[model samples]
Target: MTDTATDRSTDPQKAPSTPPQGGQGVMARIRSYTPTLRVQRVLAMLLLIAQGGITVTGSIVRVTGSGLGCNTWPNCHDGSLVPVAGAAPMIQQIIEFGNRLLTFVVAAAALLVFIAMVKAGRRAELKTLAFVSGIGVIVQAVIGGMSVLLDLQWWAVAIHFLPSMILVWIAAILYTRIAQPDDGTATRQFPDLIRILAFVAAVCLAAVLVTGTMVTGSGPHSGDAGVGMEGRLEVDTRIMTYIHAAAMYIYLGFTLVVAFLLHRVKAGDAAKRTAWVLLAMIVVQWAIGLTQFYLGVPRWTVPAHIAMSSVVVAFSAFLYAHGRVREGGTGTSPTGSPVGDARLAASRA
Candidate 1:
């Protein structure tokens, strides 16, 4: 006999199974889980920190002369995912392999931030920033693998490092944007002249970084001991160092000008504070650069320099972001009216 509805409900074997929500299963669940703004901001902040942190680890691999510790790309010691016995010095293998492993950690952080942005229904700008960050991590990994396959060529290594800075820039912007309300209007915190100066400062910073890479390519650290001077850039280290130093001075000057303008314009306290912090970091970075020059680039200074570069980049991005803010519903209107009060008066009228 056919099972009746009551019998089916009572019989375990005959009971009708409930289909997954909307029949979309995991994807539906993922779509349903919305992250709070605070959670999203935390994820973004973590991504920013991870982007900066990996550069330090990469510097460790370079300074340790362990770039080719595993001696292969997409595998450690060839035909293996981890370090192989006697493939290289155990420490070198571990260092290089460990650095490679960190790529995943950074990528995981990027993924989490990306998911947070999407789940929170954040604005397009935030979404794009998160998306680019994830993509940037993958690009960095590919470039890293290519650098390994190319035997850690100077240019290849530079190519690998620069994207990381770009990713850091993106992550910084993402962190800044995540804190802004989705429904908000753009508010300029400073005058257009100051904004232009900030733009020039950013350009100078880019030059400083690019020239700095050139200096590195001409330096003693070729990422691997075996690489030596074979594939190193042919430029004279002294001349490249001078050029890098010049670019840095110009960047520092422009940053100082920006800070001056911020004070002159009586900008928001946050903008002024960011400008001050950026100025301080630039000074510290300049001192580190001088120490590297005078001390002949000590091994310990490489990572310190690299870490400070990341910090400087993040703060530079932050200072620029502070130039423009998104004014939310509760924020002041461009005409100096209280946003909520203006709406209230309009409604009353």
Candidate 2:
């Protein structure tokens, strides 16, 4: 006879068998774990911070002339994932190897945010951004390895920095995107003038960054002291610096004009606020650049300047994003209603 409810507990057959290792049960359990939007928001923030932060650490390695500390790619030293006991100065090895290790921290953070986005069934937009961020970390790692293999060539170093700026831009986009209500649609808040100026500002910012890297390539700091200045860009440091400064001045002018337009159109407070923040960042970054120059580009200023560059890029991206469709309105609307009442519920988290 079949077991009755009363007999179920007493019957060995009624007991669940041990789940198969790495079977459906395990996957089901994993799938059942969903993260709250608040938790996801925090994780997104961490990913954003890490993407920018790692650049600072990279600058540290460069400024300290430890770019080739391990002297190998995909390894700290031959056949080792970390610094070897007697290979090179311990300080150089430690700094270079430690910076490499940070890639894992960034990867882990991005993975967490990606998994959370998927588990929560977030919109495709959010998932796509998270996915790009996850992949960006891998791409950055590969480029870093390439930099090591290329002997820290100035152009290679510049290439490495470019991708990171792109990744930081992407991360900033993800941060703002995720800040919206979990299930809400999105729409634009600014008028056409604001959007157009924002685009111009972004273009100017890109120019500024590109020229800034060129200025770096011609400067004394060649990533590693031993890398030598043989392959450094042939451009005069003074000329490149002046060009970079000019580009920055133009960028500042565009940003200020955009800020004025943001107010002229009477855009949302969020848009206005972002404009002001971008302006502030621009001023601060400009000051840092000038100070670092006259003060003779101290090693300490390298990290600070690099860090501010990341901030400037992030905010430039942010201002551009604010001009686009915002957190909530028509989720599928490409050109969302500018005056739509929909707004992100991100403040809840």
Highest lDDT, which number?
1
Worst 10 residues of 2 by lDDT: 334-343
lDDT of 1 by residue, 56-88 (tens): 999999999999998888888667989988888
Off by over 4 Å in 1: 1-31, 330-349
RMSD of 2: 6.0
TM-score of 1: 0.87
Question: What TM-score goes with each of the models?
Answer: 0.87, 0.86
Across 113-193, the per-residue lDDT of candidate 2 in tens digits comes to 988777666677888998998898999899899989889888889988888888899889887776565445457778777
**Worst ten in a row by lDDT for model 1:** 332-341
